[model samples]
Target: MFGDLMGMMGKLKETQEKVEATKKRLDTVLIDEQSTDGLLKVTITANRSIKSLKIDDALLEDKEQLEDYLILTLNKAIEKATEINETEIAAVAKDGMPNIPGMDLFK
Candidate 1:
């Protein structure tokens, strides 16, 4: 029984390393998304932090429109980032990944 438990712990360590490597890969895959009009756009990391934002020169003329576009585009970027994280984490977690406190299980 002790041997089996040790083996499981080793396997868990391997999985944890793999997940860390995967997360490092995600840092390289920045997500960029824009609204339909291209008046606003945002870049984000898989961890859901905004990297940057852009706005069209024309949209600058209307402050209210620019604000609205910023909000809309930001939401789109964040949603896309969430999807990206989920897809990646799910793919790796197919083999009974361990769950630790504060780990982004769903990613």
Candidate 2:
């Protein structure tokens, strides 16, 4: 029993290290996708928050349309960020505890 407890503690420590490494890897990856025409660009953090947005002034001629496009593009960016998070969570869970059901406690 003591040996098993020690093994579990070792596994937990390894998992914590992997989680930190994964976060660092994600931090370097850019989720900055832009509109098709490049009129709008959005940068999102690894944790799914908007870091910044750049809009070309040329799109402002049609203010309403620009507004709508901005909304749409930001939504797309948000979705992309969420997908990244899901992928990361799954990867970490699978790496750490492949045999457990619903092991995504880190997300």
Candidate 3:
């Protein structure tokens, strides 16, 4: 019983290390997305931090449209960042808990 407990603790430590590594990797991962009309572009890190934004000069004439496109493009970039974050975390979980049966269900 003590051995099993130690093994579980070891696994937990490994999982925590993997999670930390994933977070560091996420800081460097970025997602870029643009509005449907290609007027606005947004770049966000996997940690959901906005790194940069770009807008076409033509869209500057309409403040309302520009705001709308900015919101849309930002949301798209954030969504992609979330997907990448989840995937990386799931991979860490899988790698750290390989001994668990049916663990793929968590992924």
Candidate 4:
């Protein structure tokens, strides 16, 4: 019984390592979003770190419009990044999980 417990513990440790690695990898995964009018463009990592922002000169003419565009575009970018991040992390975690009796019920 102890042997089985030890093996399960080891598997859990391995899964944790894989999950951390996957998170690091996600930092390089980029998600790009642009405003509907194509006036503002944003690039962000799956980790939700902003990589770059490109704005059209037209947007600079109005402060309020620029803020609105920025908010909308950034929100879209964040949403996409969050989805990718969660899916990737979940896939890694689920694949690494060791099969245990009754665990399938949670799925």
Candidate 5:
């Protein structure tokens, strides 16, 4: 029993390390999103950090329109990034989890 417990603890620690590494890797995974009209483009990392923004000159002429575009496009980009991040982390965690009786975490 004690040996099993020790192994489980080690596996958990390893899973934690993998999760952190995956998060760091996600920083390099870029997600790009553009407005429907292609007037505004955004590049963000899977970690949800903004990398760059490209705005057309026409968008620059109207403050309100620019704000609206930014809000809509950025939200979409963030949603994509969040999905990637969560899926990657969950896969890592689920793969590393020890199979304990009556514990079906991944399901």
Candidate 6:
């Protein structure tokens, strides 16, 4: 019984380490998305931090259209980042952790 408990603890520690490493990898991932017309672009990290934004000079003349395009472009970048984050996190969970009852519900 003691040996089994020790083994389980060891596995838990290793899994924690893997999770941390995976998160670091995720943080470094960058997702870039742009508007359909290519007038606006946004770059974001997998952790949902904005890295940079680019706007076409032509769009600057119209504040309303520029704002609308910016909002749309930003949302696309964030959505891509979220999709990648979810996939990476799910893979990490599946690979590093043991299956538990009711865990599928969360996934």
The local distance difference test score of model 4 is 0.93
lDDT of 6 by residue, 1-107 (tens): 68776776887688788878878898899998999999888889998999998999999999999999988889888888999988887777677665545666435
Per-residue alpha-carbon lDDT of model 5 for 13-98, expressed as tens digits?
A: 99999999999999999999999999999999999999999999999899999999999999999999999999999999999999
lDDT of 6 at 98: 51
Ranking by lDDT: 5, 4, 3, 6, 1, 2
Clashing pairs in 5: none
Candidates' lDDT values, in order?
A: 0.80, 0.78, 0.87, 0.93, 0.98, 0.84
Evaluate model 1: give its lDDT.
Answer: 0.80
Question: Which segments of model 1 are wrong by more than 4 Å?
Answer: 96-107
Model 6 steric clash pairs = none
Give candidate 5 misplaced runs (Cα > 4 Å): none
RMSD score of candidate 6 (Å): 2.2
lDDT of 3 by residue, 1-107 (tens): 78887997999898999899899999999888998787888888999999988889999999998988988888888888999998999888877774655556664
**Number of the top-ranking candidate, with lDDT as the measure:** 5
Instruction: Give the Cα error of residue 84 in candidate 2, in Å.
Output: 1.8
Which prediction has the highest TM-score against the true structure? 5
Pairwise lDDT winner, candidates 2 and 5: 5
Candidate 4 local lDDT, 1-107, one digit each (tens): 89998898999899899999999999999999999889899999999999999999998999999999999999999999999999998888888788888887326
Which 10-residue window in model 3 sums to the lowest lDDT? 98-107
Better structure of 3 and 5 per lDDT: 5
- Candidate order by decreasing TM-score: 5, 4, 3, 6, 1, 2
Worst 10 residues of 1 by lDDT: 92-101
Alpha carbon lDDT at 58, candidate 3:
94
Per-residue lDDT for 19 in model 5?
A: 97
